[model samples]
Target: MIELPTLYHLATPDAWDAEASDDYTVSTLGRSLAEEGFIHLSLARQVSGVAEAFYAGRDVILLALDPHRLSARVEFEQVPGVDDAFPHLYGPIPRAAILSATPVPFAQDGAHDFTGLLPEPL
Candidate 1:
């Protein structure tokens, strides 16, 4: 199977702090995992859309995760009417899985831009 070099997860400051701990076994989506049964994630190409839909005007840190380092299973599933499949983590994302954490940049109009957050396309 082909592996994506990186995946993105938009997280709050608290979540970022929690994930920084060695004991942090769960990813930032603890509540989502328990309630929705999976942690929501996005591909590099889908980042902007997801951010606009859910994280607009909010201060969020983008998590750059290495799928290879993830202890939990990562699946790419399609959403209704969406052309591309999105990455979903079946379990909590271990901190080690996160290669880097950077604040999502915003444009003058208050729109979030996800460009340059990841390395070259996979």
Candidate 2:
């Protein structure tokens, strides 16, 4: 998979914007993502499990698991059935079910450490 981590769109949106949004929208979006475990990950890799989770069609927290470099965090709408209905999921029944998700720039310092929030050497 070509890890295009440099692509700028894979970023999280600003918090001020969230504050501007109606609380219901934010809470519902968060709930949907959390239910699916859709962690925000770059869409650069084909085998990225994280990417697949977001494909589940729920809003998610996008960020670089690698901490040494700065990255963007953001949310997106998951269009269900569209991923498979679209001509190219690279496989059959490609619908995504998120294992979990979080929304924040700084990785949570506690149990949220499940992802290690650090870069792995290639």
lDDT: worst 10-residue window of model 2: 86-95
lDDT of each: 0.74, 0.28
**Which ranges in model 2 have alpha carbons more than 4 Å from their true place?**
1-60, 63-96, 106-115
Instruction: List the candidates' TM-scores in order.
Output: 0.82, 0.20
RMSD from true fold, candidate 2: 14.9
Cα deviation of 67 in candidate 2 (Å)? 24
Show the lowest summed lDDT stretch of 10 residues, model 1: 23-32
Candidate 2 lDDT, tens digit per residue, 33-90?
2343433233323223333343233233543222112222333345474342111111
Model 1 pairs in collision:
none
